[model samples]
Target: MARFTDDNDADAEIRALGEALAMLRRERGLSQAEAGQRLGMTSQGWGLYEAGKRSGLFRPDVQRRLTGALDATPEDLALLVRASSTPSALTQPFKPDGLEMRGRIFEGAPSVERRRLQLSSDELAPWAAAGTVLEYVPGRWPRRDQGCVIEMADGSLRARLYVRSDEVELVVRGAGALLTIEKIPRVQARAVSAVVARLDEG
Candidate 1:
């Protein structure tokens, strides 16, 4: 059996969000096929979004791709969330110009709450190519072989493969080189995020 929320407003919001997404697509003069291509999805998949299928559209990872693909802003997405009956982070005040909050962009809009890393080098080629935009969740621990962004005490950033971790250091392999990054109790790197997805576009 299909599940439906007891709240009547929630149902309406889902329909509204889907409709709003379709409207946004049309305003951008994008056909479903074109929009799908930009978001790394097929035309048929894109159509599902416009059909009022999903009752919610605030998924952080999914929104990152959608906004980035359509060149839309957080404020633009917030407008759609207003019609949603459920509480959402998108309903909060946000600047379309990309504001930062706690190392997050757009005031942590669910669609854009994650940190973004554009690969500067093919140091992790075959998995993450140069020019790839990696979206990750902060404070998310990564397991062995997972792609991650590590912050160092010296304020340096590195994209590496998580090999193993300990209280003292984290073993990583990048660019075919094995590296050990020492941790500083308070100032050193203890921050790591697992790469959830990669978006590559010119």
Candidate 2:
């Protein structure tokens, strides 16, 4: 009976840890296959960790490697487990600093509008590859070095990295066979939306 109880406790801890890892991966908008690719492993291998079948997940070195691939720390995984068990933490909506807004982009317009575009070229390269889907929020100003989708007044669209903008022009970088800088007149750009997320297809 004592041995059986000890096994049950170990299983419960493993399951809790796995749940935390899955939550972190989903929060980063990564699929199991995509997350596995970061660690040079197959999706099934990654799934084993999330299914609590992989005992190596309890190792300190393995924890670091797995969490680092997700751009997180092992401490974050532990905290997430604790937070998940708290009822109030689950009820509160996440609001990052400097993101609060009160007004719509335009009269009769929604407070936020998201649009998706599929990349047909590798112009964005390592930042975003060909066949990756970009989710952008229109009317939101992009920060420097962020990805953006630009709509030209002439009905053409471009995906590039945001550099800076002045009264005269908007400057951006294009990553292709070679890096190129482009400056478009402010008057010619109909809209510049910030890319919020990149979804890579498996």
Candidate 3:
């Protein structure tokens, strides 16, 4: 892994801000669609933004929305822009196969605490795609009724997990304030999980 040094502190700051946005989205336990709804965008739009695909463009309004959605301070987005434009010695480790890395994309390596997830269905589509990246952190579960990722006997779903009188209710979010819940069989609702962060190209 490459090191972030003081000489390139400005660029480091920019990269860190992107990482922070990735973290906030995961912590909220929201799919891209859900997150987009909050930001007045479609899930696909949010996906493009999060994927770091919209570089070399400036949209103040979108930036403001993103800042609010990500809980970032006012100037944080500016720093991200600067870092995105700056060239630094730090680069994504090159694969020996000689293939080129993607351009204008985020490039952070994965840490032990982070693991990637791919959406498998349109059941959560618009909020998450059929193959979207979700980062999971394994540790202290969030409060009951909070969003979670669970692998039960039936299958896996990203829903809010609440414990009722001897039962675990998995609640799924729907479009336009709609929500659904199912009583998960103890045998099936095993291996419940929580999201901690998201992995991006950077």
lDDT of 3 by residue, 1-202 (tens): 7654664664445445445455456665665776677768898887766565553113556667776775554467664454455446246443438676655655654544645666555444444445656666555354444445666575655544344424544444432223444565556666656665433332
Worst 10 residues of 2 by lDDT: 102-111
TM-score-based ranking, best first?
A: 2, 1, 3
In Å, residue 26's CA in model 1 sits off its true spot by: 26
| Candidate 3, RMSD to the unseen true structure | 12.1
- Index of the highest-lDDT prediction: 2
lDDT of 1: 0.65
Per-residue error at 33 for model 3, in Å? 9.0
How well is each residue in 75-192 modelled by candidate 1, as lDDT tens digits? 5765766635335554455344776444443443445357788988877766667898877767777756667888876777778777777776677777642343433343467588
Q: What is the lDDT of residue 172 in candidate 1?
A: 73
In terms of TM-score, which candidate is stronger, 2 or 3?
2
Which pairs clash in the backbone of model 2?
none
Name model 1 segments beyond 4 Å from true. Answer: 1-112, 177-188
Q: What is the Cα-based lDDT of residue 86 in candidate 2?
A: 58
Clashing pairs in 1: none
